[model samples]
Target chain A: MPQVTLTVNGKSHTVEVEGRTLLVELLREKLGLTGTHVGCDTSQCGACTVHLNGTSVKSCTTLALQADGGVVTTIEGLAAADGTLHPMQEAFREHHALQCGFCTPGMVMSAVDLVNSNPQGLSESDIRHGLEGNLCRCTGYHNIVKAVAAAWPVMHGKETVAAE
Target chain B: MYDFAYEKPTALAAAVASLAGDMDAKALAGGQTFIPVLKQRLNKPTTVVDLAALGLVGITVTADSVTIGAMTTHGEVALSAAVQKAIPALANLASMIGDWQVRHRGTIGGSLANNDPSACYPSAVLALGATIVTDRRSIAADDYFQGMFTTALEQGEIITKVIFPIPQKAAYQKFRNPASRYAMVGVFVAKTAAGVRVAVTGAAQGGVFRHAAFEAALSANFSPDAIAGIATSADDLNSDIHASAEYRAHLIGVMAKRAVAGT
Candidate 1:
């Protein structure tokens, strides 16, 4: 086993893993951070999404060893140290953005990344098109769009209305 | 995934040497397609060479062409100001590939190396008359692609970059598969100083290919009306659940018209 050092959330973790170990497997099996769910083994489903070096990437497709020098942020790290829900999480709850919630963690993580990077504004069509990579069987996408729009201000410190 | 030794080479020489040392070694690029297949045990290799550390990551624009490094992510290429200015069609094609996550991780080299029949990158190469640069040699687009999941790359050869000439005008149109987002039918058309080239993906049984008849028609008359009577036979086209060969043939014409009309 190759020893690998990676900064997850805010702490550093050193673990021995097979060189071929995937980042998703390391997060779920080794670190016990099961919030990032694996929907499709292929990179098709954005369910295994996480922020690697500040950009959203599907964890299953990213090898653990490749992230050796990179900092990774999972859903577990989204909350405040005092256990306060992130604004996106709060918005999702308020808007009923999830059904089974299997894809919520990844969805919220990706949404936060999207809104943070986009400062101009995101319309309903932009949110839907931006989150097209994520699939949700239960939510008909009405609330997911609402959650993203509602959380945009909290995440970006800006207020905007979604044009109906 | 099958157990295999993995090597992340920091240099191109190291990557090639690692592959040359192991007969059953495969270069791992984006891992968008290859990784899933590896996990499914469809491909079992003794060693895997990871190219992330090689520093082959940039988009360079020259006087008449653009050079994209092998390890350049689709997102980088799509959002690159240089690429957008020089060849907006390429940027548009990159943006439409798979989805955000896929674009974030998927590299052009990996997509070309894997050579999935439904992939989008190959059509760009064929249409723009790009050159596939390897550590060993440079290959023109016409000689690079062989068939499905095949390329002209020899063992241990690493693709360094792909050089695409700036086109007069070009556009790519794709009908996406709703589930996987693979192209149900993708067409790339480019008008260059040499001539007009038309390449189609997802609709072909072998892989991405140019349409000589359509190219000839466009070369004669650079208008949609020129290809009004041209017919794409279904002899070697793909026929699957997404689209029948006949339907794909019709799409070829429709997409060609749209591409020419800049719609």
Candidate 2:
């Protein structure tokens, strides 16, 4: 077994896990951060997407041992310290970007990462292409694209999350 | 998950040494493929040597070629100025690989080493005549890919970098699977200083293979209309739920024509 210490959601967590333990399992089981869902064990689905050291990665395809000493931010940690919803989360809710909410956590995480990287704003095609890894059986991607654009001004501090 | 020893070696020699003592030891690169296989319990090694700490991430462009380290992530390659300037077709191919998360973690060396039949990297590697450098020896792209999920790598060997000769003109066209986004019918066409090389992925019976017929036609005329009359036999192409061998065969021509047009 390997011992891994990672900073998740602004908290440092140390756990002893098997070498084969996936990072998603470590986040959900060990740290009790169950916001990151595992839909497909294969890497095809981005349901377990999270930010690793400021970049997005699929937790299911990453071993916990590989995340040792790295910084991981899951969906649970995207909120404010006092439990305020992030702009992306609020945009999803306002835009009705979800159906069953199965892929919300990952969708929001990827969207945030996308808007964070593309400060100049992304087109609908860019958003769709950026979130291609993330699958949503519901919504047909119409609302997801809206939600990303809705979150842009809020993310860039150009418009208020509440105003949007 | 199985219990095993984990060692993150910062040096290539040290990483190889960790694998030397244990026959069941595995080298971990991008973890895009291995972690999923491990989660499915397809592979349970006693030791996993993580190469992320070995400092093998970079893209170096020279006057004649570009060498990408084994650990360079797909995202890094896609966004690399050197790669874009040296070979935009290669950069475009890298950009189309998987989605955002997979691209952030998947490495060129890992994909080439894994030798996935539907992967996009092998097409570029073979089309551009890249050289695969391993810890033990260097193998040319022609000799690297052997079969499905197989390569020239021996047991415990690790890929260090891949050196690709800058082609005179090249382009890759892929008909991706809707759900998985893997290439259903991908064709890479390159006109190098030596000659024109055409490599097709995702439709091969074994793995990525060179299309001699397409190459012969392109050699005669390096134009899109030149490859329009060429026929690709369906006998050796793949057949499954995504596409039939006949459909894949049909796509080979369409994709080859687009590739020739540099689309």
TM-score for each of the candidates: 0.97, 0.96
Q: After superposing candidate 1, which stretches have Cα over 4 Å from the reference?
A: A159-164
lDDT for B58 in candidate 1 is 97
Tens-digit lDDT string for candidate 1 (B187-206): 89899999999999988889
Candidate 2 docks with a DockQ of 0.81
DockQ of 1: 0.72
In angstroms, the error of model 1 at B215 is 0.9
Fnat per predicted structure, each in turn: 0.69, 0.96
Error of 1 at B56 (Å): 0.4
Model 2 ranges with Cα > 4 A deviation = A162-164
> What local lDDT does model 1 show for residue A70?
87
Tens-digit lDDT track of model 2 for B106-216: 999889878999999999999999999989999999998898989999887889999999999899999999988889989999998778899999998789999898898
Residues A1-164, candidate 1: write the lDDT tens digits.
88779999999999888867999999999999999999977777689999999988889988888788789999999999999888899889889999999999889988988898788889999899889888889999899999999998877766543333
Q: Lowest lDDT 10-mer window, candidate 1 chain B?
A: B254-263
